[model samples]
Target chain A: MTDITALSEEQILEKLLGGNEIVFEQVFNKYHSSMQSVAYAIAGPIIADEVVQEAWVSALKALPKFEGRSSLKSWLIRIVANEAKTRRRKENRSVSLEAIQDSWSTDPRFSENSQWKNPSSQWHGDTPEELLSAEELKNCIEKSMLKLPENQLAALRLRDSGGLSMDELCNILEVSSSNVRVLLHRARDKVLKVIDHFQITGEC
Target chain B: MLPNCKQMAELASKNLDTPLTGMAWLKRKIHMLMCKHCSRYSDQIKLSSKTVSTLDLDLPINEDVKKNVEKTYQELHCRKDVSQ
Candidate 1:
């Protein structure tokens, strides 16, 4: 849709800081997808896109205050990261780390094949469904994720879902490696609680 | 019912990850040996996560946003506020 081919990070920064709208436009078109990946990796597709747009405005507004200490690409990405974190905070949703230890029986995401636990039925006929219905946990997880503590959710999305390493997550989160792991553990716990809570209520 | 309702229930929860283990694993083994509710709950959670993950979701960007982006740039870019 938007014609964003490519430009070195420096050139892109020049256009954006220069307030050249045309160059700005190109930069946006170029990085939007990558930004979405980061956003979605940090949150989800819905919030990712929004974070991208908001990051643009925030970066633009902050341009005058920009110091030439860092690369523009990294700086812009940090803006996006901050925006996504803020969005998650506003929503107040988060995935609980307890998912590992909690029961997701009620959440529709893990429905159907408890049979795997059935030693007798392991040899039974007609295989039951394997995966949980995404629709079932649709709004629940996303909403919960938004409510999670910013550090925890960001850790989960960036590392577990986004495939970022612990080091990378630490870099992105601007925290110590150990701190990132702690946040991730806590966040996962919260998600489990949500799923388990749903099971307790028989929603699963 | 399982021996430890809370513990088993907690263990029964693991459908959230791949090859779910740890506390959940102990929960399953304990429940399977003695408890029924926990076993069922665990089964249910696994089924739910699997079902949930399989769901096909297409969350689209707002149409108005696209229109606004295109329209604003087209209109604003075309105009320059100058001393008249």
Candidate 2:
């Protein structure tokens, strides 16, 4: 059994194609969660796993032609994203533009002037180490993240957590680069407000 | 002209993704130097975004799924190898 953790893209590709079960398993575990997130974003949670499964099959078939143009992870994620989009279209589920717009306008946090009506309070003990150490706060942040509007959550997940570039985000979400920037800003603002509220009141 | 606190906050959030450039960049720096609230908001939001990104929210892929994928891959590849 090969320890595929430290392998480069070229090496990993070679081992995976060489019928190494351990290498295959390691690769699957490494990316399944991120792919699941992309799938869920595009197709919703019910069929997210199905989309990921299909993506794996698609990637496996296309492996022989997998050019090293992009990192292996990026290539695989793009496949998952596209697969999920196809599934979403088939299911006839789409996020309405009106919903996204309404959420932005009716956001109670902002004033008519688009400034924070009740500006965010300073957070206490919010260092990265402190954040990780505060299990309750961590849980609070995660819950708030889940509650965010779908598009905002998806944008945040792909850019920040999935480590995708803005260009890739624009391509996946079918939006322009400036739109991607605004989406990310709005997403981060919502998350920050959650943290602020949590810090001030000790409630999520 | 320099941006106000409201606009400053938005710019600060945007700055996380892309740097402020040209005159707007200079203005933001000067404004943050003077406005304590916006400065704190800027710092806190950057920290908040970083912390939130580090949160483990990915949907779990359990052992069953992994095993299934592995088995499927092997079957597909093995068949292909034999055919070729």
Candidate 3:
């Protein structure tokens, strides 16, 4: 009944290398979602699962050579990102950066003068925990997230969920720092609006 | 010139990713002080970002995929053992 979380990186690496099933499952559960997000961001949803699986195979094959240059999670994410990118190229799927429209100028919440026409209402639950406590609201947010533009969704997932640096995001997404900021903002804004609407009306 | 409410909202989101400094920081501070709506919007965006970051967006790993990966892990180690 060892607590895997209490184990150091070296210890975890040792367990992984030794083919410890418990440690392996624990590590997999902890990072699978983030890996999937990175995969989805790069390779598109249709092939994201395949990309993650391939990345895992590659990672396991190369695990013995892991030098701990970065955290295990970061290393795994990098592997998945690379796998996804390669798959994207093979599929001839290019991320449509041009389709992301900056609707901020015409956003109905503001007037022609850029003043607040429909200012944000005070939310009942302020903290992240409180907001996600309701199952319906959580579903709404997830749905809204799924509807975001591909690049924006990728930027948001990589930067927020994957805990990647902005520079790393730029490198992975093949966009400039300014473009990354725009994508991140647009994605976050959509989530904010979804929450706002949910708060005002008890619907998703 | 101080940014309008719309610009303030955008800046607020950007500031969360990277802190605002210099004139941008000062402008945001002053605008937030004078505009309660923009202030609330900023707080909401921050909360949403925090929530999204903490969310477990992962669907359960498919059983087939899990089994295949596990099998691959074992085969990899078995090959290493043979090589040694």
Candidate 4:
């Protein structure tokens, strides 16, 4: 028995295409949430799981022809992204392509001179990584993430959590590089604000 | 030109996508040294981006769903092998 865990993903893909269930299952469990997040952002929560499942079926079909262009995770994510967009169209859901300019312009965090009106307090945690592992903070960040605009949420998830490149993000989101950057910044800013608020009040 | 806190925040956010260029990088750095708020904001955003990237969303696959999907794949693979 080939220890599926011992091999790299490329090796796993080789076995996976040759009918290794172990490799397939390992990769599936590892990537399902990321695939689902991409789908959820593009297709909404109602059918995100369906889209991910469908994408897997599609991935299986295309496994033989899978070229090693991108990493396996990214390739699967692209497939899920495509599936989500198609599903979105079928469901008649439209994503707004408007530039993400409004919130930044009127942000109450800064004054007319663009200086801090209310400077953020230092977080209690020593490091951001430490802060991320806290259950209360995670709850708050997750809640704040949901409240973000669809485009921003998708951009943030794909770029940050999904480990996709800016070029890939622009292609997936169908926006310019500048827009993708803005969307990501906006999304991150909201979460940062949430953490700042949480630290000061001890509430999410 | 020296950037204000709002501009600093904007630059900090954009910095995640691409590092600031020569003049822009210098201005932001100088401002960050001079202003505690902007410096804190920069640290917060950088930390935010790092932490957020590693965060797993709330969704977790159920054991039943995973088993069913694995079963379905196995069956399909078995059929393909038999047919081939």
Error of 2 at A190 (Å): 1.7
lDDT of 2: 0.77
Q: Cα RMSD for candidate 1?
A: 11.4
**C-alpha lDDT of candidate 1 relative to the true structure:** 0.51
Please, what are the lDDT tens digits per residue for candidate 1 over residues A60-113?
667657775665655665677667766766776443334333233443333264
Per-residue lDDT of model 3, residues B1-84, tens digit only: 899998898898899879999998998999999999999999988998998887766465767777888889878764455555
* lDDT per residue (tens digit) for residues A1-204 in model 3: 656889999999998888787888888888888788778878998988899999999999999999998888878888888788789989999777874576776899999999999987899897988988888999898888777888888888877776778888888788888888888888999999999998999898
> Model 2, range A1-204, lDDT digits (tens) per residue?
578767789999988777777788788877787777778777898998888888898999898899888778778878888788788889998743333454655667667866557767866665866865767778777777777766777788777766677877877777777777677777788788777887788877
Quantify all predictions' global Cα lDDT against the true fold.
Answer: 0.51, 0.77, 0.85, 0.81
Ranking by DockQ: 3, 4, 2, 1
Model 4 lDDT tens row, B1-84 = 798788888899888778899999999999999999989888898888877766667777756657666776786663564555
> Which residue pairs show backbone clashes in model 4?
none
Q: Going through the candidates in order, what is the number of backbone clashes in each? A: 55, 0, 0, 0
Interface RMSD of each: 10.1, 3.4, 2.1, 2.7
Model 1 - which docking category?
A: incorrect
* Per-model DockQ against the true two-chain complex: 0.08, 0.47, 0.62, 0.56
Model 1 misplaced stretches (Cα beyond 4 Å)? A1-10, A17-19, A98-176, A179-204, B1-81
Best by TM-score: 3
Cα deviation in Å at residue B67, candidate 2?
Answer: 4.0
Taking all chains together, each candidate's TM-score versus the true structure is 0.40, 0.80, 0.89, 0.83
Candidate 3 achieves a global lDDT of: 0.85
Quote the lDDT for A16 in model 4.
Answer: 82
